[model samples]
Target: MQTNVYNIAFAESTKQVYLHFWGCNIKCKGCVCQKVVYDFMLDRNMHLHLAEPRGLAAAPERFMAFNDVIDTLVGLEAKWVLFEGQEASLDPQMPFIAEALHRHLGTTNVLLTNAFVMPDLRHFDKVAVGLKAFNENLHREYTGESNRTILENFPRIFHSGVPMMAETVLIPGYIDYQEIEQIAKFIASVDKNIRYQIDAYFKAGNNPWRRPTADEVDRAVEAASKHLNNVYAYKGSEPREFGVKSIFPTEAELDAAELAPAVESRHLVYA
Candidate 1:
């Protein structure tokens, strides 16, 4: 089977592997992918400031094979696998990958999705949904897609028996604290105990929005706390407790890499 996974990073101290998929159904205006290609934690320097868009970072020409993916995970001795990047749920082989990881390596599987497409949840140990905005118009304006399905999917995924959490980015002028409260209330309606995380929006692309101040993030968290029992805020640039290394398309390979330009291919999903 084919997989959308293009990049992989491993944290040795944490025994966790991050699987970055290549495509997204909805395009967000301030997507971090437009700036940095890999997770910040995986960066050797762990730069606090967002790097300018460097195009596709070491991405392969084609999607990886199922056996190749499994072998790499097994070699990493991964205890956990996080399916992230543009969108994990968009990958048709996600369920199979999660199941194989659990069955063969006994690894915990976590999915970080935009909540645009709901995938089979039975194989996943945890799910983190990105709740962009609660207001329909605002959500559509920011993500370039209607959030009706995302709104509907959140509740369904919560009731699916797998542990779940919700998160949103705090764009200073746009998706502010008031908007966060609406999202929190919506999640609370399903279950007040569901964990909600507020993230500071880092500057990316030519987007006019700026990163929220620590005070702004705190206010958004405070607002969200009113409806949800568990609310936390993240600056998105926290220092990593462990070291991370690129597993797939290693630094050497990427140095010699001759792939398509990021503008033309970063968002493309090969089947």
Candidate 2:
């Protein structure tokens, strides 16, 4: 099966496989994919110092083969396979891939998506929705898409019997603590025990928003905690406990990779 998977990384300590798909449904102003596509945890300092966006430096020429993907996962002995980067939900083969890996390797399949287009939750063990903003106008202004479907799908997926979590980037001026509290309240309404994570947005391209300070992230988490029972903060700049090694396209291949023209057409544009 041909797949949009471009980059894959394995973290020995965590026993997790990071499966990165190429295209996205909505274009966010400060999308981390535009800055760095590979595991930022591999070299946090270099990624942190990047002033300009690298665009699609990690884009692959074509989709990967299903057999190759399965073989690689089997070899790595991955306990968890996280479908992320750009948007894994955009790939039509995601459900099949998740099912295949679970059946053949028994790897816990997790998907990190923007929740604009809901995937078949039956195949996934857990789904983490990247809820950008609770306010419709702000969400559209930031991501160039409406949050209507995303908000509707959140509860729909959660009620599907699949484990679910919600996360949002804490863009200081654009999506601050106030916005986070609203998102948390929404999630709490569905189920307050659901895990909610607030990630500190990093600078990307010419986006006017600045990165939130550690203290600012803490305040956002505090606000979210008021509504949700489980809330956490993630500062991407911080060092990770374990190092991740590139599994599919090695560091050399990623360095020499170029975005295919056809791939741009795959990016979903909201009508």
Against the true structure, what is each candidate's TM-score?
A: 0.90, 0.89
Cα deviation at 26, candidate 1, in Å, is 0.3
Where is model 1 more than 4 Å wrong at Cα? Answer: 52-62, 255-271
- The Cα RMSD in angstroms, rounded to one decimal, for candidate 1 relative to the true structure is 3.7
Worst 10 residues of 1 by lDDT: 262-271
lDDT, model 1: 0.82
- lDDT string for model 1 (1-271, tens) is 7888888888888899999998899988888666556555565525635544433333346568888999999988899999998988888888899999999999999999888888888889999999999899999999999999999999899888899999999999899999999999999999999999998887676677778888899899989999999999898656557788877768565444434244544442110
lDDT of 2 by residue, 218-242 (tens): 9999999999999988876655577
- Best model number under TM-score: 1
